[model samples]
Target: MIRFCSRTKLVANLIPPSISISLEQRHQSIATIAKMSDSKILIYLMRRDLRVADNPVLHSLIHNKDHGFTHLLPLYVFAAQQIEVSGFIPEDGGKSPYPEARSQIGSFWRCGPHRAKFLAQSVWDLKDGFEKIGSGLSIRVGMVDEVVKGLIESFEEPAGSKVSAVWMTSEEGVEEKREERSTKNICDKAGVDFKLWQDEKYFIDDRDLPFEDPKDLSDIYTTYRKSVEPLREAPRPALPKPEKNSLPPFPTDVPPQHSPFVIPTKYEEIEAALLKLINAQPLAKNPPKCPENALSVHPFTGGESHAQERLEHLITSGSITGYKSSRNGLMGTDFSTKLSAYLALGSITSRQIHASMSVFEDGSASDDRYKDLKGYGKGENEGTYAVRFELLWRDYMRLCTRKFGPQLFRLGGFKAEENAHLKWSRLDSPKDGFSKEQIQEIVERFLNGTTGMGFIDASQREIYHTGYTSNRARQNVASFLSKHLYIDWRVGAEWYECMLVDYDVSSNWGNWQYVAGVGNDPRGNDRIFNPVKQAFDYDPKAEYVLAWVDELRGVDELGQIFQAWTINDEERKEELGIADTDMVKNPLKRIDFKVNRGRGGGVGGGRGGGRGRPPYRPHSGDRWTGRRPSSQDQGRGGWYGGRGDRGYQTRGYQGRGYRGRGDRGREMRTGMMDKERDATADNE
Candidate 1:
């Protein structure tokens, strides 16, 4: 197979203030490229996604071997261009001023010293990965296309090889579109073969598509499944180690920067000054590492290696098996997959995830493997299609961006339209430019979660402090804040976008619509959260509330769980207008996995639907729905409390145990979050 990589030698060491090569300058300078070899090479640059296995473009390149090709390279270029201009600031700027939603920008790929160190570490590890295979990188600078073109010119002719083809896949905005097109156009004019792959993430892949087009597809989810049932998926192919002797040489310098030194150095000096100032003046002993919070955790490495470590930990320890049952407890890491943060960066790919699930499911039917097949419907379905669906959902968001173009990000909130009228956040108080009292009220509680509403207050505090909240808690808190408290959901969603480690841009926006009454199932009315009821049902023992909100700890894990909803009789009249006699008691629920260990029992869930619906508008059927029975609907609901006990209150749960890792009453055995990343969670 033909191979190509960026020429590190071509990268300039220049920093910003120098003008980047213009398209004309690039064309003029790369004119020598037209004379290169008989066949051409197209090397797709990889960003955070560095794994070879399950790479579709790589598969296509391998498949094209018989077609007289010299090399198929997945090239990665290093230059200032990769730097997020908006993310970096001069020393005098006093550290990054980005809002929380955009905080990842600061440390993404290691923003400054910490990020630079992490990138150096990851790149160093990558160098090892390449060395193992005998291939080095072609690091280059300047315009991406210019550097790429220069390499094509320089490598082809002397090697008696023609650079006849190119292939690539991308996830980006307007500028990326132009670059891809320009490169393709140049290759075409040069008589080179060029191909661009389409990404079909979201609901399903194209081959598995229920119909030929979006309009022809099933209107409902059920119909969509039935139509695609005939076409089953084979386990996606895995990549073998690359042939080392075939690797290209490692380049040293990258392109020079050209943007007015990017940021002023003075800002850096100011930030250092501020760090010292803040630390000295703050009443608290330790000032925040970040002006806001600790953004640099060892838990913050971005790359495939880290992804693997997390996956290994989850599966080997059987955490995946318990994901369903305890995901909602809100107590600690054991309650959720901390994959999202790494996922937010392009560090890991979805296919890498699917293949790992395969390893976990392998076994003969006669062994314990047969038992693992319980909830799988004994159908021998390879993996939990539910997890697959969510992964695909991530793809769908990526797909939406490409398919819809800039319009996808242009609209505001759930409704594919502007929504400036809603009072968004307290920070947007009279200062930055908001005057509405309703807006101010939400801003008040959200800034620090001191709201008297314990459940809401508890969740807001946890996320603000540690950047975490269970899916159940997130939905419930969001619903109460927007629907019940009369605040706009957009503000809350933005806050999450800033704080969530696993935050996927599309999913975050998509989920907000699902909960805030916009997007797909946009509900026109309110879907208020009943804090008291929600606390009792999800955190039933209220251990989660106690754990996050210290004052609430030791008071009562269960007895007064519905405290916000008049946990006692007196408050019902004040909060929900229920009579003292109307305060119905709900019992605590727990898993007895020994009795229902295998077969089909496990887990809870999240997201989706169009605009205008109540926040957290869950699908109609399935466990984990947790729909509290209204007076009229109470009689018809099924018993969720457990077998023979009828007062369960319709908490739609599929059922299973929490992966044992972070269980409180059990042994604590987790390695630190940072160390776990290096071994990486999504492993080979």
Candidate 2:
């Protein structure tokens, strides 16, 4: 496990004594370097685009030999503000002085432990890739603009080589765009060229899009999907990895101490430096590790090699054929592609995934290497198409971010004018008649997974500990928080930003807005998910819920385990092994579906009378009915109902079914499920 230290210790350990001098002192030190190169250097600013293979910016730099650049300086800056203390810091035993990011609404570390560690791993892998091709990566910790300016100044005539240009992959986020503008301004002042290369992270490039202007793209996903589906087979191919001779020699004239920054080359040194930066933050009490008992189905290691290996395994193992059916699965690694993290970090590109799928579908992969594989030439199938469909969705989200701009992070989202009437609780201030204390209580319970809802609690716990959860779980939890708990949607979105290992700015914020009824949802505010029905539909056997929420494991009866609040005090203490002092006695009091049957009420309500539909009413056969299974209902999927005698019908179950048993109940339980449920049940 990773260990954390005080902020003072963090700062002390961050900078090497040799390079810890002031700007003026650093310039003097650089001037002492005996050797100088006349060759112009081009600084390639590495950001989210972490890989060397298929990287458009790197490809352009290497291929365009006559571009007037003889040497490449691949630089990656760990923005200090992102890693510094922010929000509430338990390690400090008080609030942090640093404010939240301009794009953020909450007070949480912008880069949590998992994200920091993953990023470090990616940087290390990228450095290794460069070294293999007779190159090196220069790393620093500072503001991007400041760092770039310093490097440009350090390379001035008398000191070393002149920096011809600074190139970086274009990003869609408001903050990233702001950083680009700032850097460009600096470059302009220095008379150095600044270029924003079109990012090749998507399946289709912007030039190939049917829309002449990206803003012309539709707000609806289906409309965008139809517009781009024709180009599905035409996604840009992955550029071949650059060879040592094909690329310009990496600049190594200036000694490490004399350079503007201290560049650590070894993986151990890189990771150690990164950990000190991350652990120095007040929120980082301990290095993040997926608990030993965590139900995580796969151990995620960051790198281009790992991403490629996983993609190949998914195809060769015959798993791609069943992806469409198993994508919604809540547990295990093979349920989905599990490549989002890699894609988000740009360790792997969407074009590469598409290209691999195409090879398998066209039966062109039946070569000697694939002869022993199980699903080498399975040909086109629903599963392969489904993967492509989801990839398009990812592209759509990014496009939406570009189109919406800062509005994507706003409370009203893209259609703010239309959503003016919608009110939500705020963490910083009271809203929707909810006091700050009241709002904090709700948000804290949701974050800690003590909401008394089984499915939501289980999902929250999974993300809180493991920094990951299924897409299905994400939707359900987002709805439960924004639609049901009435908390501000940004809180949930920002929290996910801090917690998710596969955090993509566009997808995370766009999906949150969609679920919060503030963005481009054709259903408007009417799209609500009844957690009980969702659990029944996705995790019928309660295997997923039981896997994370240990307290419910003691309840032998499957039905009562899901609806433990309905289990009486006597049964709860004796049979269920729950204590009387537990908060699971009754569900958290929030949106009561029993009374609120109007707009945004009940299970899945609507925005207005015309479109406002009643909440989803499961068919009688599908309903739990809060009664034990009878001979007729037995074996017909009617076994998981609440006790009818308690008068806790389906309405109550639907309203609060996502809550866990209790925090105490979760902590006291220490047993794992004795047996695994049929994997097929995950598809239910």
Give all candidates' CA lDDT scores: 0.42, 0.65
lDDT of 1 by residue, 1-684 (tens): 322233311221111223687655644443333222233454555544455434565455545556555444445543233322333334454543222112221111112232333343444444455556554443332346654675555554432345556666654444457667877777767666777665322234555543454445322323444454432253234444455554333322222333322322242432342233222332111211222232222254545576678776665565565564544456655545566654554445555565556545544223353344333223224224445544544544444444444442322432444342232222222211323342343344343554445566666666555556666667666655544443445455545654554555456655564444444332223333345445534554455565554543433324333333224444433454432211122111111111121333221111111122222222222111112335554343221111111111211212222111122111112111211111101111
TM-score of each: 0.57, 0.77
Candidate 2 segments whose C-alpha is farther than 4 A from its true place:
1-37, 85-103, 157-159, 254-266, 272-292, 372-375, 417-422, 569-571, 574-577, 580-583, 589-684
Q: Cα lDDT for residue 94, model 2?
A: 52
Clashes of each: 101, 7
